[model samples]
Target: MTELTIVANIHAKPDQTGLVKTELLKLIPVTRKEPGCLRYDLHLDNDDPAHFMFYETWESRGLWQDHINAPHLADYKAATEGAIAEFTLSEMSLIG
Candidate 1:
């Protein structure tokens, strides 16, 4: 099966950038240890502090689905309930 690539863009509320960033950082350590996680990297926009992105590669779509339902992920959602302004995720295939 082909590897799964996930690109997630998160926009934090203007006043909650710090909190959202902190929370996003918290996911890295744990997520990297999960099964099927190949690469999980986070980036902050140079000119837009409130914008964050996650570039992830997973072994398979099913494993990635498991990751999304993890307890830590649920906690993250609850913790950042109103702090995020917008969130977008894209699943893709790497042709190169």
Candidate 2:
């Protein structure tokens, strides 16, 4: 596969999961505009409402790096900092 994969596991503070999901939805359009972005999807855990995750496919690590530097990303990161209890990111490179 040619897609660069990123999985983000997020935990919202207290009852803020709903708000976090709403805010994360805003990233959809912005990600679509990036030249090398393939797909970006946000999902809520079936067993844990306060837990959220994002699956993103990019053209390369370079494009993903550009995403982190984008102005909107700072706000995105900031908005979720305290509101998010925990955050983990995993980057994946395809094989075969």
Candidate 3:
């Protein structure tokens, strides 16, 4: 199966950027250890502190789906509910 690449953009409310960033940071350690996770990286926009992005690669879509439903992910959602102003995710293929 082809690997899955995920690009997730998260925009936090102006007043909630700190909260969102902290919660996002908490996911890194655990997610990196999950099965099938090839790479999981987080980036912050230089011009916009409230804009964050995650670039992830998994062995397969099935494994990525499993990661999506993880308990920690749920916790993140719960914690950042009203703090997020916008969220966008894209699934892509890596074609050399």
Say which candidate scores most in TM-score: 3
* lDDT digits (tens) for residues 1-96 of candidate 1: 779999999999999999999999999999999999999999999999999999999999999999999999999999999999999999999998
Off by over 4 Å in 2: none
lDDT string for model 2 (1-96, tens) is: 366899999899867887788788888888789878888888989999889899998998888889989877887887776788899999987786
RMSD of each: 0.5, 1.7, 0.4
Q: Residue 16 of candidate 3: its Cα lDDT? A: 100
* CA deviation > 4 Å runs, candidate 3: none
Q: How do the residues 19-57 of candidate 3 rate in per-residue lDDT, one tens digit apiece?
A: 999999999999999999999999999999999999999
The local distance difference test score of each candidate is 0.97, 0.86, 0.99
Clashing pairs in 1: none
TM-score for each candidate, following the candidate numbering: 0.98, 0.89, 0.99
Ranking, TM-score, top scorer first: 3, 1, 2
Candidate 2 colliding pairs: none
Clashing pairs in 3: none
lDDT-wise, the better of 1 and 2 is 1
Rank by lDDT, descending?
3, 1, 2
lDDT of 3: 0.99
